[model samples]
Target chain A: MLDAFLGWTGVVFVFIGVFFLFLGALGILRLPDLLNRLQAGTKSTTLGVVATSIGVGLIVRGWILFAAALAVFLLMTNPISSHAIARASYRAGVKLYPGTHPDKCEERKWKLPEDGEEK
Target chain B: MRNDTPILVKKITALSLITILMVGFFWAFTEMPKGSSVNVNNRVSRLYILKNVKAATKSLNSGNFFAKGMKPLRSDVPYSPITFGKSANLEDGAANVVTSIVVDYRGFDTLGEVTVLFLAATGVAMLFFGKRKKNIIKAQASLIMSVGTRIAYAVILLFGIYIFVHGHLTPGGGFPGGAVIASGVLGLFLGNDHYESNHLGLKLFESLSGMAFVIIGLTGLFSVNSFLANFLPTGVIGDLYSAGFIALIYIAIGMKVGAELSAVVDSMIVDTEEEWS
Candidate 1:
């Protein structure tokens, strides 16, 4: 009974994870500009991978250790990778979306050289 | 002649090459036995699995050849049953059969592979030889990236070590382990703009490890009658101390490969100043 319950729960988690991953891909396609797309892509994918791996760990009795370790590694690395991309893009002078407001990077004086004068 | 080749000629050449490749592939495919009907009882793998290669070799040497289409009976050559953790002093006692085959049965091939990798590394290093500048990234790496890379590098290095050390017992081996270590070095390069790996140290380590491999093989040739033979006593299977010289060979390969790859990464990342004379 417990095994059946765990299996069903795992299946539900896997379904949710897949759904989130699909949504993340869709967001990546539809989102405006680089930063916005990265936000949608990285955050949702991180959650999706974590949940999917955990679900898989639950399903496979012997794989829990490796699965959990993978989840932790992904959780730590994904955000940092996204942050690096965002920083690189900003420094490289990729323009933000026209409709977007609130220039926090400009306010903080994080802008590098003038536009077109790439270092 | 090379640059001004006609499009029609190029297309024809590509088509002919593909046709030849496909023909060879199909010919090999026809020779392969299909489906579950294929019998493995008479195959050499049976002796490997049972750890009875010595018996089979002895039988073959003593002029006990099997008749046409007839499998060798147990009465002809006895096969000893090998239980994990109980069997000792077997000819090749690696728990991972692939490791046993690669390191013990066809070690010369592995040496050739290592030499190929060395030549490739040497080529890369030679390409970026002489006065060089750092290939600077436009944007400085973020704080998180730098710190995270340091932590991740350590973890990756440890994991690579674990992989090569357990090559005799697990699916991973020297090549993959070295790749993992090189990836860590790549991360280091990305995270730090001024990060310079010690060139002399890497070269020395690489050469030393390569020499170690050749020396071990020479030792085997001197002690035993064959090159790269299992000279040491292979302990019980599944133990860390088992598999004769497989673990030692893997360690040497792992170090050599890691150093070579790291040097390659260093050469590629550091920009060479062009001398357009």
Candidate 2:
């Protein structure tokens, strides 16, 4: 009985994780900006992977420790990578939408260069 | 002007060529003997199968009567799986036949492969050497990245070590394990600019390991009367300490590859900086 319940729970988690992964892909394809797309891709996919791994661990024997390890690894790497991409894009002068209010990162205020002074 | 005719011709030619190659490969695959007859009724074991195979070869060779329409047979080198698969443990005290073959039977080939990697690394390092300024200040990674990278680096390094160490017993060997180790170094490079790796130490390790590999082979040649022979005592068939020379050679390869790859990455990173500067 306990095994069956655990299996069902694992199945549920796997389905939910797959759904989130689908949403992440959709967000990546549908989002307006690079940052928005990157955000969706990283956050949702990381969580989805963690959930799926944990679910697999529950369903399969001898994989629980590995699943936990992979989850920890994902947690360690994802945020940092996302931060890097965002920072790099910002430094490269990828503009955000003007409709968004109070752009704190726009404090630098990139001005149009004089015609001859372009690097 | 004449673009349409040429384009059409090129497409048709490419399509036909690809189709021909695919069909030829498919036909060859289909013509191959598909069944694993050995496992059908558990009748044929090691010695019997080998004997039968030999017999079959002899019979095929004996049939010299050629027909007018038949294609010429290219009977070349005979393959014997029983030699390695059955007597691997007996020969080298190694459980894995593939490992035995790589480390024992064809170690010279592996050495050549390592030398190729080393030469490639040297070429990359040379390309990056001329433009490098003494003690160039590198940009530091952000706080979040630094912390995360530190954690990831440790874990990856540990995993790489595990892979290299347990290579003899497991499916993974030195090449992949060393690549994993290099990835850890890459992580460190990403984490912080102040990641002070000892360039001297890396180079020294690479050179020393490569030298040790050759020296070990030479020593085997002198002592055991064969080049790259299994001279050391093989401890156990399946244990960690078993396959003495194979294990040592793999360790040496792992260190060399890891150091060389890390050096390559370092040089490449420097090369990129030169491009921007």
Candidate 3:
């Protein structure tokens, strides 16, 4: 009974993972800006990876350790990668969307007149 | 003859070339036999699994083929293919056949591959080597990015070490693990201004590892009367210390690869990490 329940849960989790991945792929295709695409890609992919790995672990024998490790790595690295991409875009002077409000990082650049001044 | 060929002739030549390439690619893809389709039952892997660990048997291809060729190959293999992935666990006492094969069976090939990689790294470093200009200021990454990159770098380094350490028992091995380590250091070089690769540390790590690999091979030659023979004791299979020289060789490879890759990266980023004056 427990095995069946776990199997069913895995199936459901896999479906959910597929859904999130599909959404993320769509967002990547449709998103206007680089930041928007990265945001869509990272967040959804992280969650999708977690769900998919868990699903696979439940379905397969002796895969829990690998799944857990992969989840931990994805969780740790995804946001960090997104942050790096954002930083790269900003450094490259990529303009924000026209309709977007005032940017805080841009504002902070004006606030700090000299280098090594900001905490 | 005119300086230029006719447009019609040019088009025909291009078309013929494209058609030939496409046909060649398709023929190669379709006609070639897949490795997976081959009967594993006929392979030495089947026999390797059934028997207990022993000294390397002289194969028909290697030597003494005429006498040994008389006996029929074993058919009563106890375990199926599913249960036994590779005979490395039973015969060689190494869990990972990929490592065993790469570092043991085809070691000389791997040594040549390593040499090629080293030469490439050296050539790249030499090509990029020069005195630094004082005026070229590098822009620092954002605080959040810097912190995140540092954390990621640490995680990646740990993961690489783990990969190479468990190479004999796991899916990953020295080459991939070393690449992982290099990428992590590359992240540091990109994010941090003061992230200079220590020449002494890198050089010592690389050279010592290379020397250690050679020494082990030489010791095997002396001990077993063969190059890179299983000289060290093969402990019980599936343990960290089980694979003996395989693990040690992988560790050495990992260090050498990581150091060499770091040297390559350091060469690319001249201003940040310069060679000694």
Q: Best-fitting candidate, measured by TM-score?
A: 1
Q: What is the lDDT, from 0 to 100, of the residue B152 in candidate 2?
A: 82
List TM-scores for all candidates, in order.
Answer: 0.81, 0.73, 0.78
Higher-scoring candidate on TM-score, 1 or 3: 1
**lDDT score, candidate 3, position B101:** 75
Top candidate on DockQ is 1
Model 2, global lDDT: 0.76
Candidate 1 reaches a DockQ of 0.32
Give the per-residue lDDT of model 1 (tens digit) for B30-64. 99988777775677677676666777778667765
Instruction: Report the candidate with higher DockQ, 2 versus 3.
Output: 3
Candidate 3 per-residue lDDT, tens place, A25-117, comes to 999999888888888898998898899998988877489889988888888778877887787687777977776677887766643223443
TM-score rank order: 1, 3, 2
Candidate 2 lDDT tens digits, B1-277: 3556788788888899999999999999888766764342222233133323344345456773232432322123354344433333344666565677787878999999999999999999877775454444433456887788788888987888777777777777788888998998898887775566777799999999999999999999999999998898865467777777888888899889999999988877653335433
lDDT of each: 0.87, 0.76, 0.76
Worst 10 residues of 3 chain A by lDDT: A110-119
- Give the better candidate number (1 or 3) by DockQ: 1
User: Looking at model 1 chain A, which ten-residue stretch has the lowest summed lDDT?
Assistant: A110-119
Listed per model in order, the count of residue pairs whose N, CA or C atoms clash below 3 Å is 0, 0, 0
Q: Report how far off residue B46 is in candidate 2 (Å).
A: 8.8
